[model samples]
Target: MRKYPIGIQDFEKIRKENFLYIDKTQSIYNLIASGNYYFLSRPRRFGKSLLLSTIKEIFSGNRELFKDLWIYNQWNWEQKHPVIHLRLSKLDYQKLGLYEALSIEIGILAKEQGVELESKHLKGRFEELIRKASANGKVVILIDEYDKPITDYLDDLGKVEENRSIFKSFYSVLKDSDPYIRLLLITGVSRFPKVSIFSDLNNLNDITIHRKYATIAGITQQELERDFADEIAEIQQHQPDFLGKLKSWYNGYAWHEEAERVYNPFSLLKYMDGRDFRNYWFHTGTPTWLVNIMKQNREYDLENVHIGENALSSFNVEHIAVIPVLFQTGYLTIKGYNSNNRLYKLGYPNTEVRESLTDALLSAYRNVFPGNDSMSVTDDLSESLKKNDMPQMIKALDVLLSTIPYDHWKAESESIFHIIVHLSFKRLGFDVRSEVHSATGRCDVLVFTDRYIFALELKLNSSANVALDQIFEKGYLRPYQMDARKKIAIGINFSSEKRNVQDYLVKELE
Candidate 1:
């Protein structure tokens, strides 16, 4: 029974403690062979720290840690380089300022390596530490979550700019110390432009979307099946569709549009340990700022977002774009790419993000905390849809709508009702598409379930009869005529005065 290294980011500890380590040394070897300076951007808990830790151990000549791994024989163990490992997420920037926190961290590293620095400021000390640590050989620098200081204070413009300035000064040492550095790999959740580290360090290769190293950070499908074969077999005994369900729930994260999708390793491990399917990764931490941003930009659809390659790569902190932030933070991922136009199509990575993010956005819109009764109401709506209980479904939807604050409903447009209803069904984990277009006409929403398909038309300050007539008149159900599931047509009307569903009609179609 091999132990899962849940929340454990230390490579040496995982190997020595007999944890089930997914061998990523092959990718690491390729990375080292390909470049000396690299930057990786991945969402939180996707094993960026572990990757850096593994590289640190490798450079430190930890041969025993890679005994059975791919790099054990491939690497030249005789060649050892001093490593300067810094995890910005672990730094005390909140208590101490960025400059002081970084100074202490570098000082500790220098102390560990038995080196003394005479420099007074961060830039000089960092340069001094690198040159001294490379006395025997060039130093390998691993900086994990390098942008944490800036990201942590996004709500405060002054603090963000201050941290940016501090980072710009501190990282300026890297370009001058290149001769003393063997390899530098910086991992973070986002790459902000004008950080100077990026502009000054012109040699740094950003492999965030590079096809060759797309699978370097996340656990690919092959790795998952190859690694957790025993766990899968055991789970399949009771849940026969376990593999398929798992893929649907968690295995759709892709960095390159053509690369194989990977699973959120943290969430996968949690599911393996508990044998329960929940929002493991999203629950660990969803940035309140991200949720607030989504609430402010409610008009932007979360699916099929198209962005240019350059625009998708980096954004400035002063002018942040929600789509790029969503993509960088793992809420969205590359789904398709057009080489001719250099455009990337992005969407929700998988069911986990779609459902969890929708719930969070709904909570923000309602001005309530998460885990409110709206979630249970959505659950009730799901149950009603599963049983084809039209009356119960309408009642549940009404309750959900009633919970929304009056300010949200002040707009009193059909689109708002459509968005709320779409979000409600989407949060229920159904296959939902809003403003679906067909040859004849467009439908307000279309919901697909295992046993039923629904064509819905929404109207505000109008009668449900008119909405139902439009649904049939527009031939919204024509496209799903051949679908095997039971087909139903639903029309709903919302009253601005009541701020809830006023009337709804549901009809079965052959």
Candidate 2:
């Protein structure tokens, strides 16, 4: 069996060490041929660094590394260009600051090319390097994680703005030195607005959502089947449903409306290594600041988060919003796109994200670390729901709610309880919808399982019977009556004083 390159981002190292590599050289060929300046935004650990490194190797005329790769014969080996590759993620901006890091990186690039800079500023040094490097041949500028410096300081707005100013000035050199550049490519986790990073470089083509390049940074199903045929065969021998389960857990990322689905390369590789399905991608780096921002803003209702094509690409960290940040960071993905309306519906990509993100939100809302407490409770709740054990389900949820810290009960609205119940069901891999509309009125929560349909109504400072009465009075279960699955109505009341479930009731609808 060949070694899987889990953390190896260097193209030459992978080729030299004989690590398992997926062929993405065709995409690189198309990328260079299609545009001079390009920008691609993808989630972290989705192989952006590897993509950049591969591009560097191609531009630097490393033909030996592409021994059996697709672009070996097609690429012009004679046309060698000076490659100035800078990976911002390698620097700790929190310690050195953006200006210092930028200066040090640019200085190193200059020292490599034996070029001298007239000015000490980052902008001047960058411009001077491009001019000198391109004097012989046009310079191929490759930047990886361009937004890392700015995103690192998301919590500190003053520092973030300062870094943005430095980036704006530094990157403006790309536009100014366009004549001296052969190809400029930037890859990052998020794409900020023009006023933020690419204000001057308006001509930079953003192929993030382009159908052709959608699979550039991810592993498509075809690539998986083609590259890991042996592994798949072995897994199928041991686990018959391995492929189906694998697809459910980590696949289904679509950039365009009709684009083919792609899997998270990091998680897929990790799963392949151990044959254990886990939230490898989400655990890599939880968006703590992103979750905190959503919690602080009280943006709990995320089921209907919609954005037009324009708004989806508009990401500004300074004025942080939930939709753009979550979508860009891989917490949510494109579910559906309405061509007529030009609006995109966003949701969690797969079970890993759907379960893990809700768990993160649960932790943030309760102001408690998500140890085994919540997980155990959700597990018990799911089993109870499966067996039609209403009392056990209620007990599990009430116990879980009681664990929330008293001081965390700051919200007086009923949405808090609604959101908690919704998240709990969602975390357990149950289909849950909050504020779902019915003919009579909107239901507080609707849960769907293979054998049961649960309609729940939650009341804050009222009797459980009152909530139950409202469920029947409002005809909340009417829509599910015609379905073949068993229908159940549940009511729960919460007390702000106790910071736990006050009472609960459940009824089966005939």
Candidate 3:
């Protein structure tokens, strides 16, 4: 019966107004006690701003706000630190240059501390503010969305370089003014520290992958089951499987490979508000540009993707790779980490991202938008396979393949076609496994429904019978031979000139 803090980012407002608060004060206490300078990277709307606001209150010696919180008596409230909080998300870096945005904010902050700075440069102005604010005690610096200005210019390399220079000069003051700084916490969406902009601030402890802080921003399963037990009980009175459905939809965001996964706080709260388990998280900040970049870079088909541990967090503004961008931006997450090999296996975190990202990619690369028609395509395929209607299944595939534009077929490789087929079936709620391995060899695509299993082999500029022959010879259907689901072997040939399916052959296993 408590009101959820949907847009309230202020800690004082939430506590005083009696809004629902999932106690994160323990994590805040740990973070503040353990380090002097720290960095945390989380996805947008994942409660980064709120965390910074809470830290601001704690450092400012607001004792009344912490009456019932975990850090109430544990923290030292006698020493009050002047908190200088800056949110880079407020500035429009595209319209106003990066320097001007910093200058304006720094000017206002300096005036608040009863200090005037005549310096026209950003670095000088920032240093003056730090010195003046810490006249009584060390300054607590909290920067939310620290990479917003630079991220706003991701498409323009020239502008990005200019902004990086500005940031490097401005942030270098933190290193020099470390004597007057009590605690510095920087929160952003990405941690591309290899860029020269962050080179001078070398003492920052990046807790992004640290297991102790993984549950700082998002709602852990323990918090969900405990904090919203009443809500769950009420919903299950009508729908018994709501909890399972909710977990499958929005509950698999993992910061560390072995850390406990947490539910997206924004989507979970909105779902509780609407009482519906929909794709609420994906719509918050859709990465349309990410999809466009992936489509442009042909090397990034993103199926069964793996990257080195260093490559996971190592990107610069000048040369940002597709894997790091996707991983940092929350489209992909750490599925598995091999410490011996120093490699990470990345994939979509949950069903919402898997389906929504596929829909976005399908819409970006082709004329066909993902909707009921695409759903019907898979539905038709499922029905055709169940009734043993080979022609109907082939016809359904033809219609689906024809939706792709002709130019895309000419310019892209066979991998694009494979991705389209893979994503199409995946978006339809089928358990699709690309590049699946069997006893002898690997199959191109394997689709599993409730009662049917499809082993599809795709060929470009080759005979359909040849593809079907390879499937039989390699025993691609061997793994599912004894399963209860009916097995179907399908071979489809695509023509580069026609940009559609040229031939199709199918054989059902007895």
Candidate 4:
């Protein structure tokens, strides 16, 4: 019945309080022995700070705190090194630029070690801190959210570069103190390219997308059941099906081994606390900032879905000589990869992220209204599915055609009009295709149900005859006409001037 350190990132505080902790120490134990400087990139609140604290604990030779834990019995506890933990995320992102923020961070970590930075210059101050740690013995460097400042200023390219410059010099100090460093482990939301933040330390091992350790930071489903079973049971008491709810809300993050899945640790805990499956993962971090990056780059697609790796990863923010800022930021993650192709499928990491992102996109990308409007339009299609009403479905093209927002085009919303209609009908369980090829040209939309295929064209102040003729001349419905399902040609004209469906046309294809 110990307290769970829900958002508490400090190891000492959480440990002394006897809070519930799922052991992730083995990875640290392995990591320390494995490399001198290790860079790990995980999503926000995936327990990076806690991991940093855990490293501090291990390095301090605080073996007594780890009784019955995996590392205590597994590791040789005879060794303990002096640890210098610098938490960088604590600085105010808006109030200070990179230099000032680094100064504050250095001062705090140095204060704990009884060595203050009396100098104003960053290099001079960091030199003093490193000297203190080395004077005591090699420092075990642990930095949390190392990229917060740059990421905060992602919109302001000026600041991203400034922050990168500041960190480059700051982290380079580690290279100078390479001899005194016992184990250097830095955690951030995403990995910067070698030339940027870690410029001074090119050899820094980046284990962000490394398949071997993706599970190190987040909670495994097994761990959740084992450590928080009671909490889950407690939360589920109000729900008829708690397990299903948990799975749907939180069970879709996969980060390793070609095929691995994980729940978002931050969201999962809060959901346990409130017993409501809120978007605990998006709790004011990662998503919107990522959305900003997309908006700035104009890379987020409203119409199509992409599954290729490096699709969004190629856009580099100015003055940043590193990995694509997007991948490091946790908005995009490796989905699946083929060894032969060296190609990876990148996507939003989990079910919660996908749905949360979709909800955000629906609001940001499209103008979808709430509720079952699609069912009203497709009830006949639904019936057609049941009764196999190809004839009725093909004939219903006229009625379906009538649903276009003709006024929306004259209004000139551009992409908004097309995106809304496609998403609207997509909700009805039809494979909502957009920009489909036709005899006259490309149709704006083509919704295909089990019973019939629909070809639609949307335009501002365009007539149904033009939309329908495009369908007929371009042979938009020709490809699907031979299918067992009835073929239907429907032309929809949208008025950009207004945002509602204005006119639609439907015709049967042989």
TM-score between model 2 and native: 0.96
Question: For model 4, how does the per-residue alpha-carbon lDDT over 1-510 read when each residue is reduced to its tens digit?
Answer: 547678898777776789778888887777887889888777777788888888888878778888878898787666666677776667775777667767777787788888867788888888788777677777787877776776667678877777777778777777778777788888777554345667668678877666667778777888888988777777667775877768756765656536457777778777766766566666455445554344334343333333334443333565442224544555456666677765655555544555445444433332222221333454464465335444564344334434544432233444555664554454333466777665556777777676666666665577768878877777777666558987766666655444444566767776
- Which of candidates 2 and 4 reaches a greater lDDT? 2
Error of 2 at 440 (Å): 2.3
Per residue, candidate 1 scores C-alpha lDDT tens digits across 1-510 of 669999999999999999988899999999998779999999999999999999999999989999989999999999999999998988888999999999999999999889999998898999999999899799999998988888888889899889888888788889899889889999999876434556788888888998888888778888988999999889888899989989988989999988889999999988889889898999898898888777777743588889997788666777678888899999999999999998999998988998888888777766675555257668888888899999998888788778876765554468777777888888887888888898878999999999999988999899999999888999998887888999999989888888878898988886
Query: What's model 3's lDDT at 169?
Result: 86
Expressed as tens digits, the lDDT of each residue in 113-179 for candidate 3 is: 7778878888899998999889979999999998888787788888877888888888989998999
Q: Is 1 or 2 the stronger prediction by TM-score?
A: 2
> Per-residue lDDT of 92-175 in model 2, one digit per residue for the tens?
677888888888888888888888878887888888889998876999999999988777777778887798888888898888
TM-score of each: 0.94, 0.96, 0.92, 0.78
Q: Model 3, which residues run further than 4 Å from truth?
A: 299-304, 367-390, 405-413, 437-441, 479-484, 495-499
Error of 2 at 499 (Å): 3.6
Residue 250 in model 1: shift from native, Å? 1.8
**Per-candidate local distance difference test:** 0.87, 0.85, 0.81, 0.65
Over 4 Å off in model 4, which ranges? 92-97, 116-120, 192-194, 231-245, 257-259, 286-315, 319-327, 365-414, 423-457, 465-490, 506-510
RMSD from true fold, candidate 2: 1.7
Candidate 3: the clashing residue pairs are none
Any idea what lDDT model 4 has? 0.65
